[model samples]
Target: MTRRDDIIAAAIRLAEQSSTGQANLSVRAVAKEAGIGASTLRHYFPTQSDLHEAIARRYMHVAINDFSIDDSARDPAERLFECCAQLLPSHEHRQIQLDTWLSAHVNGLGPERRAPVRRLLEHSHEVTYDHLDRWLQVLVDEGHLDAAEVAPSSTALFTMLDGLALHSIITPERITVDAARDQLRWLIAKVLEPKS
Candidate 1:
């Protein structure tokens, strides 16, 4: 990796490790973790804000890429469930990212400082919406759902997924992946079932 990449990686690691407490990171500390000198880190990052922005951007990208929609699940419902599973992070990692993100927001160093972070948020949302749209199309094509019901169904499904993600993050012990998948399937079945 290039020096810049090394520095960014070190910053992310530092942020992840120090996210829980009052451990204020320093250039020297990050450089030590990164196996580089403090002057080298300074040459690349220049300021604490710059380092923070880099770490935040890297975190956002990692989160976005963690959800892989490329799996060969021909069934739209299965693909949706897979995507949902990706949304549920390990409890420890989720807490770290959540704490770091909240801290960044409080410190006024969130997406506002970096256009890439802002774009990542927008793109991630768009990707989710697009996946839902495709699922709706599949349902309609299979005669399981009415074509006219696409918009409302997609909106409701996305909202449900978002709610489930928040709940899972807050109560990781209670919200297992299987539970989320089962609930999602039940909701979709209810929305798509034909009138008796």
Candidate 2:
């Protein structure tokens, strides 16, 4: 692996280890974890936001690859659903991730610290949007969606998926795993609907 990959791997390990999530992923800590000097890490990731973006992208890549989205034997809609479903955490992992995110980003903070936390949240949203954008682009390329619809479609789809994921985590009794999947499938159908 490249040094850059090594550093990201170290950060992922630390993130997985910490209950506080990526909020506690300080440069000094990541550098030490990677067995590299702070200066070396900076050379690869000049800023905290850059490092966070890379980490988020890596997580999404791994998550997307874990599913059989490439299996052409499955129906296209099913394949699309699987691709989008990758964005949502599985039933067993949802609560843990939600709890970690809350503890890291939202649990306790004054106005003074809100700015940095807000930046983190924005970066997280952008990463999610970016992944959705790519997935939608593929559908567009395959004539399943309009090329012009990507921006709005990605935004709307991400919003729904984000809400569905959070609700499923917070109130599984109301938004059961099957219910969330049904909602996602409905949203995908709407997105794939041809423009009038």
Candidate 3:
């Protein structure tokens, strides 16, 4: 991997660490984790904002584009559900993501702190919608989704999944992981199953 890729990977690793769960980790801590001198890290990142931006972009790319789903899994609902599930972060990742977002709000640093979180969340949202839209269209083409419900159904499903993700993350006690997954699957069934 290129030096830039190495630095970014190290940044992600540091960000995702339980210790660095919050977004305010010092650049020195990240550099230490990356096994590089702080000066070396600064040579590439120049500032914490630059590092945060790079890490956020990498997170979006991995979370949105790198995951694979089975289109020929014989169960369209399951397939589509898997596709949507890829957008949700793991427990550790979720904690880090939530901390990052929450810290941004708490600091009230305006663009300086919130920029990375805003960019990451917004890009992830758009990418999720695009994926959902395409999957809905494919479901219709495959006779799994009814043509009549294409527009409204896709939007509704996208909103549901997005809301569920946030709710599950912010209030895990209220909506347990299994409960969230079950709800998602149930919603998928409603959209994919033919009406009686």
Candidate 4:
């Protein structure tokens, strides 16, 4: 891997292992984890915002794009639901993600502390939306979804997934994985229904 890739990977590792998760991806911690001087790390990232953005982008890419679920034999609705499920926190990481979200958004931060956190959340949403958009278009190309349904369906699915994810994190007893899966599968089926 390139030095830049190494630095970003280190940042991701530190974030994952941290109490605050992604919100803890500071320049000094990442540099120390990478065993590089802070100056060298800064040379590649230039600023903390750049480093956080790179880390979030790479981490989300790996999390969503590299998910290993085998959907080849599944119907299109099932396949799409599997893809969307990757966005929700897995059992192992659910608590960590919840902690990070609470720390970054629920707990009050001064203006100086809030901007970077806000940027990271916004960038994460953008990356997630782009991936969802591409996944929906793939189904459309395969005759599973109408072209007109892509925009609204994508938005609705994203919003539902967000709420479902939060519920899974904050109240798993109420929104178990099976329940979430059923809701998502139902939504996907509705979106893919043929127009009369």
lDDT of each: 0.66, 0.76, 0.71, 0.77
Q: What is the lDDT of candidate 1?
A: 0.66
| Ranking, TM-score, top scorer first | 4, 2, 3, 1
lDDT of 4 by residue, 1-196 (tens): 9999999888888877777523467788889999999999989989887897788768766777723223435577777877887766667777676566556654235445666667767777788888778888887887777888888998999999878877877788988767887888888888888889
Quote each prediction's TM-score: 0.51, 0.69, 0.63, 0.75
Candidate 1 regions exceeding 4 Å error are 13-25, 64-68, 88-158, 165-181, 186-196
State residue 130's C-alpha deviation in candidate 1, in Å: 8.5
Over the stretch 11-127, how does candidate 2's per-residue lDDT look in tens digits?
998988877533467899999999999999999999987898788767755544425544546665787788778666567776776565555456224345555456656666776
In Å, residue 19's CA in model 3 sits off its true spot by 5.8
Best by lDDT: 4
lDDT of 1 by residue, 1-196 (tens): 9898988887777777774665456788888989999888889989876786676556655654323334434555565555545554444476665454444333444444555445545555676666667766666776667888888888887777767666666776776656766777777666666766
Summing lDDT over every window of 10 consecutive residues in candidate 2, give the lowest-scoring window. Answer: 103-112
Off by over 4 Å in 3: 1-3, 13-44, 64-68, 86-113, 137-141, 146-154, 165-174
- Candidate 4: stretches off by over 4 Å: 1-3, 13-36, 46-50, 66-73, 107-113, 169-172
Compare candidates 1 and 4 on lDDT and give the better one. 4
Among all windows of 10 consecutive residues in model 1, the one with the lowest summed lDDT is 64-73
- The TM-score that candidate 1 achieves is 0.51
Cα lDDT, model 4, residue 172: 81
